[model samples]
Target: MKENRSREMYEEIKNITKTFQPRLGVIKDEKGNILTESKQIVDRWKRYCEKMYSSDSTADQQEKLEETREDKEINLLPLRSEIEWAIGSLKDGKSPGCDDI
Candidate 1:
């Protein structure tokens, strides 16, 4: 269920980003490492969500935000804690229904 929600949000963000086409300005992270994972996702989202395009600052920034929104692979904006708990349960073999990993 959570995976499905994550996929849905991902698709929605992808659609929005392609529609905006932000220039991505630049993407070096705090450690001076170009967040390659984020950069890759941003690039793909831009290509995927192109409802229309314009040479305006707002559009580009919106796209950039939407594209770069995902901080980590497992993070879905709406279900972070739920997913985290599930993972913790799995790690501890405490999930009530699952017999094995």
Candidate 2:
């Protein structure tokens, strides 16, 4: 019964995806050039992302890290009572996180 339900859901999702149209029909490059081909669009996206991420200044990052190190101080872990209180305050019926616990 569970397997049949899972199969039905998978087929439903597949049918839905078949009817979907991609929103990004075309992409524009930084030079205002329009890309229609799939390869051109993908390459343009890759170059754009690379240029964007690479534009960050290493000197500014180092200065920011140094400022953070000077200002913040490490703190000890919470008490057992505090931990229990936090867990107890969580509402019931909430879904488990990534660990599924």
Q: Pick the candidate with the highest lDDT.
A: 2
TM-score, candidate number 2: 0.40
For model 2, give the 10-residue run with minimal summed lDDT: 51-60
**Which pairs in model 2 have colliding backbones?**
none
Judging by TM-score against the true structure, name the best candidate.
2
RMSD of each: 21.7, 10.0
Write the residue-wise lDDT of candidate 2 on 1-101 in tens digits.
Answer: 47559888988889988875768879988889899999999999899777656747556777899999888876868899999999999889886666543
lDDT of 2: 0.83
Error of 1 at 4 (Å): 78
Q: Write model 1 residue lDDT over 1-101, tens digit each, in one string.
A: 46559888988888888765566545654345564576665765574354235456568888888888664566537678888887776755354675664
CA lDDT of every candidate: 0.64, 0.83
Worst 10 residues of 1 by lDDT: 45-54
